[model samples]
Target: MAKKQGLNKKLILLDLVFYAILPYIVWNYGKEPFGDYATMLISTIPGFIYTCYRFILEKQFNIAGLFIIGSLALGTMVNLLSGSAEQMIWNGVYLGLFYIVIYFIALIVKRPFSLYFAVDFAYLQGYARKDSATLFFQKGIFNWFQLIQVVFIVRGLFMAGLTVFLLNKYGIDGYGGMLLYKQIAGWFFWMLITGMFIYINIPVQRFLAGQQDKLQDKKTPLSTDEIF
Candidate 1:
């Protein structure tokens, strides 16, 4: 089995720095020299470069990686095409809305993306994809996976509303504030969802462990076999 590459704390720290802190700093300080639209564009550079670097470093060619890169590229295109600071922000809001719709559609079809995300993680941890999928779909487990998808939808809606509220209230000058508040809000929801997942995953772990034990018992030969 391949060694599992668990979460990297350093990469996460860098992500927070590049995505949240650096952008906020650039928007605030670079605004005077670069102006609104230009600064907005400049602020994205660090996060963009960091995301690409991470993608390449991790060699993330999976669906998750593709989604990240695709979103980044789309966001860059939005920034370039946007005429003004407000338009750029609004475009992001629209993009977020589009994602929310996709999630909703996935849920309606009963093929929640959260399930696939888990399967991908399991595969990384040296589990067979087919077995993981089968286990995940087991009666008590599948519903929780759907709940995870709902959580994603809720987070998306919260963010979209928050962004619209901030943009309307703060205008272009409030970009820095938006970045700060969004990061705070994003982290809050992320932690909330993560906790829920941990709580749910405990049972899943037990179930999987029990399954493994059963498999081992089946594999072990009976003492009577030696007599035969």
Candidate 2:
């Protein structure tokens, strides 16, 4: 699982780099490839293909796959119709919407997506002798996962909106301006999100674990109590 996660991380990083660089390259050398629209379309294809490959490797047959497919379709459709910078903006919007939907689906199913992380953490805690065993259904972890999903939803929407606004205001010609704004906003948003996760998530997990420890410590010894 750790190896899978590491591979996923690498793929995501590569995806980010591809998107960030390709747009600039297309915007600059668009004339050679039947103009900007064609260039943009061609450039985006590789990322779409790579994302599909990643999904296959990850064996994500659910909403994660749906999200990627939906985003690619929406982005391609936007480009086909408008052939404007707004298509680029739609890319972000579609991705944000995809994650938001996944978050809600997980919540409604009562199997919060954060269970993945919670289970991992619980295993680590148990291994460290901090707890007897892992309990993924803990209320504290559920709450934290809900909170994080909310944060991601908000951040995703903000990013999508901001990207649209930038594209509308500057067009594809303003690569330098767009790049500068994107970099600054991207860094700021990531830092803020990371800080929130650490602040809220870490403490909640610790608090819950501490409660479990206290309860264990107060329990009667097996020798003193009759087995049922």
Candidate 3:
């Protein structure tokens, strides 16, 4: 739990640095050649590289690597074709669509999309009961992850649509104005949705945790090797 919280904190800090501080710097200093676009790209590069590094560390090459490639390709294409900040908004839409597709794929495969979270939860449930943990992984964790993915996809799509609508309604010509509006609206929307998700899930999480505890109490203790 502490480790997970630590990871979450790190992610939060990264987001603050990337989305808030870096965007501000770019908007102010980088208006000429590439405008805010250059700044936005530069700011996001660090996080993108970090994510790739993290994925490498975890030995999960497929999804993260593909995502990075796709993003770079899309970003480049958007920049080259439109040369407008508004085009970059498609990245969000692409991601949302990608996740939605993955969600459906998971359903088709009878696998839960949230395998990572379930694996972590299994570890948290205890390390001494490998078989039970594995069972939970196969049966339950994926479903929960799929549900979360659905939630994320739905929210992301809405945000993407809203972003497009706002960008079109308020042209990107008013550079600073559009940037401010996007920053404020994006932040507020994410915060609101995240808060609601947390608020709604707390009780559900507790309930699940309690159930896991009861199940764990009945399982026989085993060695790490045996469990694993």
Candidate 4:
């Protein structure tokens, strides 16, 4: 059986430092010295390097990792190419819109991305993809998966709306504060989503284990006398 991996506290701390703290620090402090455009570009460097390092360290060659890498690459490219801080901020809003569209399309097709992500997680925890999918689609549990997909869409929209508000209110000068607020908001949503997932998963996992035990019982052969 493949060992199930849990959240790494150390990595989470490192992520906060690199993704949120360092970036905010760079944006705020670097702005005067480097100017808004250059400061914004430089602020992205820490998060990009940390993300790549994490991807490599975890040896994550899976779809989830690919998605992260792709998004990181795209964001990096946007920052590099964008002529001004304002453009870079707007580009981020556009990317969020793009992701919202993809989520909506997945919902329309009745093939939510959240289901696939859950299936992938199960696969990592020693479940076969087919088996996990079969279990995940059980009528009782499947609705939650769809709900998760909706949550993703909502999250995207919420962040996009917040970004627009910040941009209009503070403009480029508020970049550091925006980054901090976004991080805080992101953490809140993430916790809510994770809790929701765990609530559904515990009972489903127990049922799966019971089914597996029954299968083992059926496969085990009795001695001749005992059978007779």
What lDDT score belongs to each candidate, Candidate 1 first? 0.84, 0.62, 0.57, 0.84
Q: After superposition, how far is residue 112 of candidate 4 from its true place, in Å?
A: 1.6
Please give the distance, in angstroms, between residue 45's alpha carbon in candidate 4 and its true position after superposition: 1.1
> In model 2, which runs have C-alpha deviations exceeding 4 angstroms?
1-16, 31-33, 56-66, 73-137, 175-219, 222-228
TM per model?
0.84, 0.59, 0.55, 0.83
List candidate 1 segments past 4 Å from native: 1-12, 209-228
Mark the regions of model 4 whose C-alpha exceeds 4 Å error after superposition. Answer: 1-9, 206-228
Residue-level lDDT of model 2, residues 104-210, one tens digit each, is 77777765544454444445444431241234356765566666666666666777677778777876666445655665676667666556555755756687789
Give the least accurate 10-residue stretch of model 4, judged by summed lDDT.
1-10
lDDT of 4 by residue, 122-145 (tens): 787888989888888886678887
Can you write out model 3's per-residue Cα lDDT over 56-156, one digit (the tens) per residue?
66554334345555666665565455444556555555655776677667656756434443344345556434553454454334455455556555655
Between candidates 1 and 3, name the one with more favorable TM-score. Answer: 1
RMSD of 3: 8.3
